[model samples]
Target: MWFFIQAALYDNNITFSTLGPPKFIDRQEVPNVPLNAPKPVIGLDASTKVATDAFDDLEPEMIYLPLSAYSHYRLRGRSQNYPLLYEYFDINPYSGKLETSRRVSDLSMLEIVTGSMRPLHTGDFVGLSLKLVYFFFGILLSMMIFSGMMIWTKRTYKSTQTLLSRSTKAPSKTTKPEPSV
Candidate 1:
């Protein structure tokens, strides 16, 4: 999977099949990993409540300590998006330990992915191109539909005008026809 491949090689700085056969980077110091467990929602629940709460204010969102990723909750900054902007904490149901977190050190993997999923100017170049292409096609589709509707409407209007003209004609002069006989 790309996720594992990214985590194993890219995150660890092991590149292959490119400029180098196998590239490795040594850390000046060892890294430390955090221990975060999932938590539940601390406040009210609703459609707007859930979505708005995440992006409304600068809150140190609670760690859902006893929930699964499906219902995982992370407090976010104002207008912050989870998959791209902020780090997340999700507790594994079986392990009861923090399982998934966003990229904290490097920007390659996250930028590579979210760039395509969402086309921000600051993402991977190819991904950004893909998103732009998708948007262009979407606009094209909308224009196609609107033009088709306009054509249909014009045809209908012309047909209605012809029918009305046929129904509302001036009466022929009866006396003028008798002169011919």
Candidate 2:
């Protein structure tokens, strides 16, 4: 939950990257991009124009960027107030037109590393490890919940039985006073 909500509650933009350097950053590869290439994928401003490719518009200090948003490449963007996220685009290669863009998030790491263990996606041996991990997680969670409930129920039942037995106990004649009208 913390990791899930942290993206929203906290404006922690991934400024520094440790993945590696971009494919082509040297010599300023000014792409012949469309004016409407840069779109707001996550936190980028809509008014942000392409301005002769995104690489040219970036700050001098900011050069290196990760690859493929769909495959775990998150690059920071320039913003005035809040932290901004960049959407890396795929080029048509032939026509040099922007094909599509995707927001690079941490979840992409899973796909890159394990390729997901959800059985419905990967092969028998490829994602089987992740599938087993998820299965164990579910079993562990169920066991924890069941054990907690059992403990609570036992404590409650014992307490109730003790009180009931005490109340239902037969009283001695001397201790048994006359009933009030």
Candidate 3:
């Protein structure tokens, strides 16, 4: 799988297929890795016995512990196979893994797939999906029904108009006035 391949070959300097290979650079030496790393702001609140706690301030975000501080982190006896990001946070990365993957590390294996990654609420996705489905089929059905109605109504209107026009027109075949004498 791509995840395993990424994990395995990422640690070593190796070339994969034309699909492009993972570029392996020693992690310890890479200053840019930490510099370029995106840290999403996380916040929390602490309550005192006297007052209800409110979120005080945004704290420094950390996804992965720096190599120097890895000892201070409580990674404990977790295996190397466990993602480094999860290890540092003391959070269970595997919480959603099984539902998200058919087997281990199957990123592409999912029950529902959208074309691109976008942040969306669960209800938003469900509602949007339903709306899209309804829009597609509903418009098609409406168009067909409208077309049929137009055809039927147009023919009836045309026929009635033709008859009305003919009847209303002065008779072209008016009989010649009979001789008075």
Top TM-score hit: 2
In model 3, what lDDT does residue 178 have? Answer: 88
Count steric clashes of candidate 1. 6
Ranking the candidates on TM-score from highest down gives 2, 1, 3
**Model 3: what TM-score?**
0.23
Question: Which of the predicted structures, 1 or 3, would earn the higher TM-score when compared with the native?
Answer: 1
Q: Tell me the tens digit of each residue's lDDT in model 1 across 1-181.
A: 5556656887787753222232121232112334573332243333224444443432333443333334433333222333334443333333233333333233465553633343344342234676677678789999999999999999999999999897788566566445655
List of clashing residue pairs for candidate 1:
38-64, 38-65, 39-63, 39-64, 39-65, 40-64
Backbone atom clashes (below 3 Å) for every candidate: 6, 0, 0
1-181 in candidate 3: lDDT tens per residue?
Answer: 5456556865896643222332232345223337566532212211110011111221213332323421111121111242211111121121211111011132232312221122121222334676577678778999999999999999999999999998989676778898998
The regions of model 2 sitting more than 4 angstroms off are 4-7, 10-89, 93-126, 170-181
TM-score (all chains, Cα) for each model:
0.29, 0.34, 0.23
lDDT of every model, 2 decimals: 0.45, 0.42, 0.35
Query: Whole-model lDDT for model 3 versus the true structure?
Result: 0.35
lDDT of 2 by residue, 1-181 (tens): 4345445534766322333443432232344456778522322221122312654443211212224322211233432221133334433322233334333343255332332232333223224586687678779999999999999999999999999998889675567677999
RMSD of each: 15.5, 14.6, 19.0
